[model samples]
Target: MAATGSVALALYYYYVRGETQRGQFVGLWPATILGLAVSLNLEQMKRMLQDFQN
Candidate 1:
């Protein structure tokens, strides 16, 4: 959901508002957010497995 919003904002800046530089910069946010989400999920799973073992 948050990633979708970020992409919409990026498109708005790029096409609607015609701010190329800003759009390009904002466009990178979704990937960053998703990457963090994946990393956090992995960490959470690791912790869950450790707890299960003990």
Candidate 2:
């Protein structure tokens, strides 16, 4: 949801608002958000597995 919003805003900035640098900066957000989400989920799964074993 947040990533989608960021993408929309980025597009708006790039096309509608004509802020290329700002748009490019905002465009990087989705990857970062997804990367963090994956990292956190992996950490959570690791903890769950350890808890199950113990």
Candidate 3:
């Protein structure tokens, strides 16, 4: 959810004004990095949870 929100925000910034809350870094680059991180974390956490379940 966080990853998706970040990506969606980035896209909106890029297409809408090419800027974001924290400037270009926030607008796209960092957002992308954070999105990737969040997504990977979610995936990893999901796997860990599944492992625990099993």
Candidate 4:
């Protein structure tokens, strides 16, 4: 979702600003989560499209 992506982006920005190892780790979490979410969503979407075609 857009909201999920936005949250991840915000976290990434925050870490960049803080410039610390901990911030870097926390920031990476959101990005990884967002990537997984998007990938899952895409798979679901593909299923929906295939169903519509049949």
State which candidate has the highest TM-score.
Answer: 1
Looking at model 3, the pairs that clash are: none
Cα deviation at 13, candidate 3, in Å, is 18
As for candidate 4, its clashing pairs are none
Q: In candidate 3, residue 49 scores what lDDT?
A: 100
lDDT by residue (tens digit), candidate 2, 1-54: 888999999999999999999999999999999889999999999999999999
lDDT score of model 4?
0.70
Error of 2 at 2 (Å): 1.2
Candidate 3 weakest lDDT stretch, 10 residues: 20-29
In order, candidate lDDTs are 0.97, 0.96, 0.70, 0.70
What's the TM-score of each model vs. the native?
Answer: 0.94, 0.92, 0.51, 0.60
Off by over 4 Å in 1: none
Model 3 TM-score? 0.51
Residue pairs with backbone atoms closer than 3 Å in model 1 (clashes): none
lDDT of 4 by residue, 1-54 (tens): 654665566666566566465555555666677788899999999999999999
Q: Cα RMSD to native, each candidate?
A: 0.6, 0.7, 5.7, 4.5
Tens-place lDDT digits, model 1, residues 1-54: 888999999999999999999999999999999999999999999999999999
